[model samples]
Target chain A: MPTSFPPPTGDAEAEDTLSTLGEFGLIARLNAGRAQPAGTLLGPGDDAAVVAAPDERVVACTDVLVEGVHFRLDWSAPDQVGRKAAAANLADIAAMGAVPTALLVGLACSRDTPVETLTALVDGLWAEAGVVGVGVVGGDVAASPTLVLSVTALGTLEGRAPVTRAGARPGDVLAICGRVGWSAAGLAVLARGFRSPVAVVGAHRVPDPPYAAGPQAAKAGATSMIDISDGLIADLGHVARASGVLLDVRSRAFDVPARLVDVGAALGVDPLQWVLTGGEDHALAATFSGPLPEGWTEIGTVRAGDPAVLVDGRPYEGPPAGWDHFTR
Target chain B: MPTSFPPPTGDAEAEDTLSTLGEFGLIARLNAGRAQPAGTLLGPGDDAAVVAAPDERVVACTDVLVEGVHFRLDWSAPDQVGRKAAAANLADIAAMGAVPTALLVGLACSRDTPVETLTALVDGLWAEAGVVGVGVVGGDVAASPTLVLSVTALGTLEGRAPVTRAGARPGDVLAICGRVGWSAAGLAVLARGFRSPVAVVGAHRVPDPPYAAGPQAAKAGATSMIDISDGLIADLGHVARASGVLLDVRSRAFDVPARLVDVGAALGVDPLQWVLTGGEDHALAATFSGPLPEGWTEIGTVRAGDPAVLVDGRPYEGPPAGWDHFTR
Candidate 1:
């Protein structure tokens, strides 16, 4: 079983590098003693993992997190990095309005990387997957010059049509479930050496995606949905482009919570901009023609217009540029 | 769509780095003109892809290829590297006795990586997937200091039970359906810079695993099976340990083909060692309790004993400690 969070800053077991354990030993150690998921027909140690697809169709996606660009070893714990990697991919599966069932984590790191770090990463993966009531089905490990996590998630739709981004129509209300820009705020906090706001730092380390909101929104007749991983405006632009509709955000609609407001003020940055352009919250943003879902809050409106995102009746020209891995 | 291979060593388009085009633009360009596979219910451009799972069961596996460790950019063309990466994972699906259906690729590379290199890699991926009658389904891209490709392949069992390594029993005939050590020999030739035998070099670049032989062996009621990814003895040892049987190879049984012998002679390397201990052949090795499958050639026999592998009635100790990333 994955060990519980033992102080992220602790480095008691960093002396054991992977070269000592070798490839098979390291893989066995990572998955040893862990309980397999119920839906796994065949688990690790096989040629491939056989996962039970309850439905006839499967939903799948992949995401890669690089070492320095995606997360710095100095800034985030190995456990947090593992959790964030799994969370990012899990959120994508959720945005498809499907229930996640399996994960295949691929790790590439320097051979000198401490085995304890890898173990902690797997522990974090197990913890996050445990929240979804599943487990890591398969994985790959390799030696590289840097650390990289490429995670692929598998889910089932339970006999429902997927809520794709191109489904949004005119006159649909755009609402969001879960907090936005908290992660970006957390990044700022970590940068400025302000450790008081524990929530912000935690958000930056491990995003708390509203896991239940995806299926809930789908059941509530949402026409289109997306998770805010690349900021509200940037993700909304994807919907706008894909659906060929304009999304107009009403600034008054979002009541900036005190957590964000307080953090932004301390750093001399606008928290609303984080809400608008900050990504990585993994919050669900959806367009609905009917009444909004219980967890969703109205944030914008959709109309038949040139494919674009409008903030308060004008194009958004904010300071927070969207997060694109290459550009960043 | 993935562009056609212009030339193996062409550098005309290598000047356009990934940073210039950015993430979204690069992704859009990579996938813009591509055609989706028939089984892809929802292709790329979505948060997640929906693929038809015809059997209500999915066989999944992943493999990560890191630059320098897995391949050298200077040694291989971008296309060959991509194909090799995809082939490694696809071979796993074949080893499961399943049909390859979908792929999710995650790529991380330096910002200075040429756009053409990325395109050629995708081209290689597509070319190999086409060999299996499918195409890329979903993927993620990131920026890092080195190039990495993490590929996850999904396959369907078509209602057949998985042929695991733990099924071989006493008195089973051990046979293999694909050529072994060709890749290892090819690697030797490449290392020595002997370019005359193009076939040997190509095998090292992209392995041609016997994809059909897997399901064939399963259908033929092979009690145990494995792909020779980490060398014959190493992989056989896995089967021996799992199945609790001793596998003894008859020296005279294997007819080392002329091509392998010719190549070995040219490089002054023992081809038999490559055949015995070389890795990355991806050949299907199986133990059949019934009549041997038509294409499979008898090489060894399985006996109920302490789990071990022997050559010509004796324990075999040879060079080429199988490819383990951290150790290598």
Candidate 2:
């Protein structure tokens, strides 16, 4: 059913708040105009979705974003929030060497929220879902004081083995499949009101990861993999700890994206800090046993040593430690 | 590291709340003493978790619960919230006729939240996850003004076809696994502050569904199925609408538990209403083409007619309508 709050008219009395849209109305609006993938046996209308994991295995991950903590309403449009939420969760599925297939969203919003905001969030979710040929299979909605989103993504491996963070071994080549520090730069621009770097600020608001590179790396025999939710150094530390091997990252070899380099110059900030300590870039970092796949850039190596991450054979020194949800 | 604020110890300075706990302390407390299931290749300590889904197919579902709406903190313990969150998500997986494999939780809590509250919440999550033979895989923690939990459940089909809500056909038998209405009864007792005949209030706080029944139904070739999350008649209506068949439930044939009958008598509310319209029971309701497997009770039959649900071919009059997150 076309459940949605009527758009507000010039009359102040016609204000369309979330209470007017209600939970079901907002969901109905969200579900409208969405397309399901070919393999989705069941979609949003059911209690749960049945997806075809033909390869006999599935990759799954979840992430939660809270307004003010993860994003600000003044800085991020509802659409951007929706896209970022989906992006963050999907990155994890990709890190496991799988193709994302479906997503389930859990939303909590205040009754005073605008209908347009809710619709924008759904549109963003659908827009991103379409990019990966995935569907928003199901979700839960409830009332809260501020907006909150929890997204869970499910993916298919097409019979490939999962490339976990623990698979890195000494001598494995470390590589990356997307840009680094772009999101951190964007966040910096947003926080500092650097109007000249609007694009960077937007990137910080909504990250776009190279999803296909996950399976590509798997096909190329990636030994260990991780999505960069935390800064590169911090994330690599996870691989080091899990694999019981030392990871040495070569920052100088990272062919920094020209756009980010230009933005860093304009903002008068250290781009390396963004690359090494910025989080939410969602780039795929993995240790491969063979030649790197196309589009994959080799940046480091795994070594026989204590579980730790180092730069040029020593612990990397940067702008303090990377972000921690609680510490921050 | 322990992230959340420490619990209050009745010391004069024990008033430190979630805000004092901040983000990190809350995470540390919530994660304390939790163990991972054997199937988990990687657990909560990482950016994402890897779990076995050897059936080549997975069933996934998610749901979010909000404070002061889904549950009241003043009324329910933090542990209850945690259990209910996991239970509801796992129930959705069960409804898909799959065995739950893992869970990923997302939490947003107020800054004033006490570390002890978060610990209790995590303990509840573990307790419920243990019931379904799964473990908490991974999660995201953030700061918010209210307690919000978003849980996603992953399930394995074990080489069996997934039973969708659309597979019911004319002449199929409708059956139920496990007791229903106990949760509803518990809710009523809690709401009215009335004495309960059994531990029904506990059931309301933490539902214990027949977890194994879902996969068993899949193995036995159930045509259609769904969990009773939103009252029986309302949920069956979904199956009828999806499967294009009418479901005629024979109320007289219902094999309700003795505790419910006793509680209904003590509360002076009709036991049938609780059975028919009570939600959150998390019981599996399925339609089979033939005789049901052992331990299942036949409750109704599918017939060709308008897509509707009836008790003995007539409208089921009850005080409770189905449960809807948005509308309710």
Top-lDDT structure, candidate number = 1
Model 1: lDDT of residue A319: 85
Residue runs of model 1 more than 4 Å from their true location after superposition: A1-14, B1-14
Alpha-carbon RMSD, each predicted model: 4.6, 3.9
Checking candidate 1 for backbone clashes, the offending pairs are A231-A279, B1-B34
lDDT of 2 by residue, A1-328 (tens): 2244454556433356556655555677678777788878777877777777776666677788888888887888889889989998888888888888888888888877766787788788877888898888888778887789988888877777788888999999998988789889888777777654666777887898988998889888999999998789888888998899999988787877777888788778778888888889799999988899999888888999999998877887767646666556
Best by the TM-score measure: 1
Error of 1 at B84 (Å): 0.9
Give per-model TM-scores: 0.95, 0.88
lDDT of each: 0.87, 0.82
lDDT measured at residue A240 in model 2 versus the true structure, 0 to 100:
92
